[model samples]
Target chain A: MRKFFVLLAGMVLFLASSLTFIYVKGENDSVNDLLSANVDALADNESSGGLDANYHRIDSKCEVFVSAGMQIDIFGIGIITAKADGKIAIDGKVVCQSKGNETCRPVECSDLYSVILHGGER
Target chain B: MRKFPYFSFVLSLVVISCVSQTKNEPNVQGISVDINKQADISEFVSSFDGYVCLETYEECLVNEIRKLKMVGDTIYVADDTKITMFSRRDGSYLGKIHKHGRGPGEYITLTDFDVFDSRLYVLSNVDREIIMYNASGDVLRIINTGEGFSNLSVIDEDNIWLYSSDSNDSMYNFILIGPDADVKAKYDKFSKNQSYTIEDITFCGSVSDTLYVSQYYDNIVYSLHYDGYVPLYRFDMNLRNTVSQEELSATPLSELHKTYKYKESFRSIMHIDRNRHTLFAETWCFLDGLALKTCFVKADMVTGKSHFYICGYDVDERFPLFDLSDVIGYDGKVLISYLTAFSAKKHGKKYKIGNLADISEYDNPVIVFHTLNY
Candidate 1:
């Protein structure tokens, strides 16, 4: 009887651990992507000698699906790339998250998607 | 075995809560704020200067929208090529004229322009010259920049802010003169600091003085708040532009979004008619996806909550300020114009004629909104 109860508690803990991993965040999640260009990719064909300016590029990528109501407020501007095998519709007007108010969180976004672009950066 | 039912219910609850965050609707968990644009524009316009003033310009004169200034009944619209004049009484199309130069139509590509009293201040590409035009559309003076300009905005009628786009991108404030423009003050006191690829600079909505600068290289927007050119908010908000494998393989849609990467930030910003309280914003940023993602959003500064309606599809002929303004006027009611019509590049090395015309795609290539009211 003592062995049976101990085994049951162990099983419960294992189930709880697995469930937590699936529910919350893990190692290679979507938000903390680190894939940005640090070196000046602009005017690389030409030497950086003539120029005296310095700037770095930063970007991140995550393939997981960001269900619907999620919103990311990029103050000035930003873009999100969606990755999937099927037709993925991203609402640009999404209410992911805003870094504005701490205690007060605003929620009124129903759409978020992607923007079409032409040509590479010059 | 006896707790099987309880375990099953708990598991379902956890899954449901996690899945609710990715949709257009709030989780029925957080606080919801109502800011419906379809809610009577008349009541909203009543508070701002009697009539709801709009920046109505000729479509042929502008492709990428810049700045719009309204003074009483006179509305001045600036494009990358020319300055358009309009009357606000009934949103009437007044007179249109190009900046004077070698000949009648001789003018450089205009990025920004400001009109004060009888004078129109213009900023051309390469910081070549600062043009001042009289009320009669005659060139009053053309002042060349020794250091050149990247962008230009109005501080007041006489003080014009000039931003450089050279190897070291920085901005300076200058005073407009009759023939020779002079430096009145150094707005930012920029001293050989390089690390920012300044694309375009504009002020925050309703803030009047706070300047928001976009650095595409850093994927950040620097908020330079007003302290008389001292900068208020230099907050860095992380921005990322991504394109998926599926988007790259899509049909004509894929061919579309890969083009607008010419400037630093490949995003276009437009203002929505602000009601008495909330401020509205819309963006047309489709430099990937092949499909255009049109973003329409509204925020209540007081309540700290916002609502967004994002819709995407092909470059429908009628999907922009042009579409919404179509109902605002008559034959020439809500006018749009392009100063220059030339394509830059598409995807690869080759450049195509860019869409410089402010096209009024009036419900042609259709799109279905995902959230809020369309």
Candidate 2:
């Protein structure tokens, strides 16, 4: 009886561990999918190119590559790729790749991030 | 021992199911407002008579009038950068209260301001301080509210109520501060753990002794009392067609616009006047395409006889002088400001504002005050 009880306890622990692992892995996968989907949506925009003189609208049919220390305002739907050494500014503040260095920071402003994520739907 | 594992698993499943069921249910309960029909402005507003014209060309060059409040004859106006005082009787500039610097008694960004008892309280976003000034534009005393607050309103001479974005586990959305800048109370009557973005849709207004607060996403409007926040009214604009918060969160940020492209969303409660028992709100609904539908709701608190008017007309058809951008309630009157140039050219003959041929596009706005018929 003692041996049977010990076996049951071990099985229960293993099952719980497996369930937790699966749940966590599933959550992580969903998060990655969300982020990748956002990136693809932004890249799908046709108007992506060098900084337009208008300062508001960047008119281009190709991918807009922003180098470090360059400030560009994106209007409508435009995909921007920041170089490893390039930085980008959004809404008057330097956001990504500042000072010739790439720093990863979480975007706090939901409205600003929504504009970037949605490719300027508004 | 063998049955113990099976029993525990069954119990856990029951608990999980109960929790999920409770979460899916609507947590709020209050009066419902169903917008079944639309009415013209004249049908609901009784009359749309203009009381004052604020066209102080250069004296009060309001670059962008963010907020306006009238106390007696002093009209406090918060423009894009600074707060300017003007005479309500005449469109003359009284004085300006812009100490734009990083020094003491100065502010980097003027977020909001309120005038009470001849004292002006200016809340600076960057400085995280409430700079108080007397009627003469002299700095009184600065109250440093250690953290950044999004909105503020003076409850009385000694107490100030402020809204701060809280990501912490705390459920409170507002903090009442004393004269010495000490937190007097923290109160909220809603489900906790709401996203930080909810703050953008939150607005607070006080009329008489009751403090009215509401989140645009939520249908309920809460009034802060001495005890706590009580659900005063609920607006049911038929948001059943809108995207649920659960679905919104599950969807990717990038796909939000596409998935909910045609979904109608409740934007914000623009103005609330308790004395007149009136509330104005702006909602975004897809009409031909995306468009704003302004709702002017009036409810009799005692009788509960409510009526709403939907102001969704072209610039020419609607009251040309009243833009839904900003509405202020003061001294039992509703004040609306319009860009004089736009109104003058759009419906010059219809509205009958004399000779705007010389009014440039850069001129100050024309303030229109309308008396509410109770």
Fnat, 2 decimals, each candidate: 0.07, 0.00
lDDT of 2 by residue, B1-374 (tens): 98999999999999997887567543333334556655445544444565344556565577756677878887777775777777777667778887777787888767678877888898865577899998666889899887555578887878888775432233456778887888888885234332222223245456576787765344456777556766655555654355455654455322444443334554446555665444443332322121234556666665665666554232323454443223444455454544444444434444465554445545566565655544
Candidate 2 residue-pair clash tally? 4
| Top DockQ model | 1
Off by over 4 Å in 2: A1-122, B1-36, B55-59, B167-171, B189-204, B243-262, B274-290, B299-306, B315-320, B323-331, B355-358
Q: Enumerate the chain B TM-scores of all models.
A: 0.48, 0.76
Interface RMSD of each: 14.0, 17.8
What DockQ does model 1 achieve? 0.03
Docking class of 2: incorrect
Q: Which 10 residues in a row give candidate 2 chain B its minimum summed lDDT?
A: B283-292
DockQ scores for all the models shown? Answer: 0.03, 0.01
Model 1 lDDT tens row, A1-122: 99999999999999999989876664445333422232334445346443432222111111112212233322223543332111122222211111111122122223222333322222
Model 1 Cα lDDT, one tens digit per residue, B1-374? 99999999999998887777434223222213232222332212222111222233434233333445555566565544566665656445566556534453245456456666657777654345667777567777667655445456555555555554222233342222223566554443334422122233333233354444432221122334333432221111112443332442341221222232321222434323334565444443333332233344455655755554443221122232222121111111122211111111111012111231232332111111111121
Report the Cα lDDT for residue B52, model 1. 22
Stretches of candidate 1 above 4 Å error?
A: A1-122, B1-70, B78-80, B89-93, B103-107, B166-201, B204-294, B300-304, B311-374
